[model samples]
Every structure is written in C-alpha cells, then in structure tokens.
Target chain A: MKIRIFVTLKNGVLDPQGKAIHHALESLDFKGVNDVRAGKLIELDVDDGTSDSDIEKMCEKLLANTVIENFEIERPTDQAAREA
Target chain B: MKIRIFVTLKNGVLDPQGKAIHHALESLDFKGVNDVRAGKLIELDVDDGTSDSDIEKMCEKLLANTVIENFEIERPTDQAAREA
Candidate 1:
C-alpha cells in the first residue's frame, strides 16, 4: 500500500523558508500573494497489511515533530490501480 | 482564497533525504516500510480574484523545478468555513 503523510507547521509558528518563498514571489512581481507557509509530504510504500496504528506510531516517533507540526495521513484510492 | 501546491520529485531521481528517513524508520524498528519519498507542500493565501493562470505561473517560476519536480494545485473546499 502507498500512504501519504502531510506534515505542516502549526499556526503561529514562524516559517522562514515560507517567508523566503513569499519574498521571491514578490520579487517576481506575482501580486495578490498574501502569505505562504511551507510543509512536507512523505510518501511511503509499505506492506498492505500495515495497521493504521503502526503508521500513526511512525508519525509520532519520527515523521513529525508534534510540538510544532501537525500531520494528516491519506490512503489514496489509486494505490490499488497502481499495484494492479 | 487559499491554495495548496504539492511538489514531488520525478521518478528515478535520487532522494537522499528520503533515504535517510527510511533508514531512520528502520532504526526505530518500524517494519513494513519499503520505500520513502519526500516532497514539499506550499500553502498560499492569495486574493480571491487571483486567476488560475497567474497561480500556475507562480509555480512555474518559483514553486517547482519543472526539470525534476512535478506540482499539483489544490483549492480546498473548506476555505469558506475557515474564513467564516
């Protein structure tokens, strides 16, 4: 199975990288961009039998720093098609 | 309006960061982890009137490296609720 994890900074956390990107956009004259926040996407190819709890444990242990980040897991329906 | 952009490395590209993450998971004894690929998620808060073409141009110019990365744009449906 293929699982996708999105790890994003919690609201109110300072994101310098995002700020840098925002500045870059402004320099390029892309108006209307109010703010930017950056995050991470981790794609994992794992055994089909891997339990949801185990996956959650993975996130808690290393995939995310829960103190400043929140993570969402997605099991894409297209994984079956891809495996087939 | 809020938009999300997912940027992922193209297939066959070497991802050292992902490799390191995979190794870390193995060290932590997370079984069934076959492969890991890492990417970026960029969130943009923009004016409601921003055109889709302008957003696409932003991605092409700064958000993604078209030579080795692919980007997907998403306009979340819950933006209304959040703004409310």
Candidate 2:
C-alpha cells in the first residue's frame, strides 16, 4: 500500500514565500488572490499492512517539521475523492 | 483569525521533483529516505468566525487544484496542537 503525507505551515505564522507568490500573482494581474502559504508532500510505498499510527509517526518524525507546520495523511482511494 | 490550507499530490502519481530531491538527499548521505512528493500550502487571514464549510469551500474552489491534488484545512488552535 501507499501512504501520502502533506505538511504545511501553521496558521498565524507569516509565510514569506507565500507573500512573495501573492505579490507575483498580483503583478501578473491575478486578482482576488489574497494570500499564500507553502508546504511539502511525501509519498511512501509500503507493505499493504502499514498501520495508521505508523503513518502518523512518519509525519511526526520526518515528513513534517511540527514546530511551524501541520500535516495530514490520506489513503489512495480516500484522497482521490476528497481532492476532486 | 486565520485559516491554513495544505495541498498535496495524490499517491500512485510520479513526483519528478520529489524524486530529484530524493536523489539529492541520498547524495548528501541521508539514508533511509525513500520518496518525496511536492505540494502547496495556503494561509488566509479572515474574520475570526469564518465557518468550517467556508474554509472547505475555499479549498474546493481555488486554493487546491483538486484534479491531481488533495487539501486539508485546520483552525489555528487545532493545527498548533496537532502538528506538535
């Protein structure tokens, strides 16, 4: 099975990169775009029996830097429908 | 108040950028590193009482390009505790 981890900056913290992109978007005439934030994704291919706790551990230990970021995990079938 | 959104690619898809970074990590002697995926994060500064559904709408409507990606929303208080 495969597990996907998404990591992102926590709220209330300033995101310099997001601000830069927001500015760039505005300069490019993309209006109504208020702000931006940035994050990372990690994909893990594992045996079919990886537990949810294990996946969470991966997010906690490696996939994300918890001090300023948050992460979420999704299974393939669940993610495919949720995003769309 | 603020809302933070995280967008990530779905599993089973190839992440060329992540692969490149993985190779770089290996070259740098970071062992046990397997694969990486890339994604985006968005931070929105809004009224203190923005509804959960409204934030969900933002993710569904624009912040996340759902076709190949998935997104999650976390309130400041929740995210701060969850990630840590």
**Candidate maximizing DockQ:** 1
lDDT of 1 at A14: 100
Q: lDDT tens string, model 2, B1-84?
A: 666676777777677877875675556554454566666656676566667876676667556778888887866775555444
Which whole-number lDDT from 0 to 100 does residue B15 have in model 2?
74
* Interface DockQ of each model: 0.50, 0.21
Q: Fraction of true contacts reproduced, model 2? A: 0.32
Candidate 1's TM-score:
0.90
- Work out the TM-score per prediction: 0.90, 0.55
**What is the DockQ (computed on Cα atoms) for candidate 1?**
0.50
The residue-by-residue lDDT of candidate 1 on A1-84, one tens digit each, is 889888999999999999999999999999999999999999999999999899999999999999999998877553333233
lDDT, each prediction: 0.90, 0.66
Residue B35's lDDT within candidate 2 is: 62
Residues A2-27 of candidate 2 have per-residue lDDT tens digits of: 56676778888787877875675556
Q: What TM-score does each model's chain B reach against the true chain B?
A: 0.88, 0.85
**What are the per-model numbers of colliding residue pairs?**
0, 1
Report the poorest 10 consecutive residues by lDDT, candidate 2 chain A: A25-34
Q: After superposing candidate 1, which stretches have Cα over 4 Å from the reference? A: A78-84, B78-84
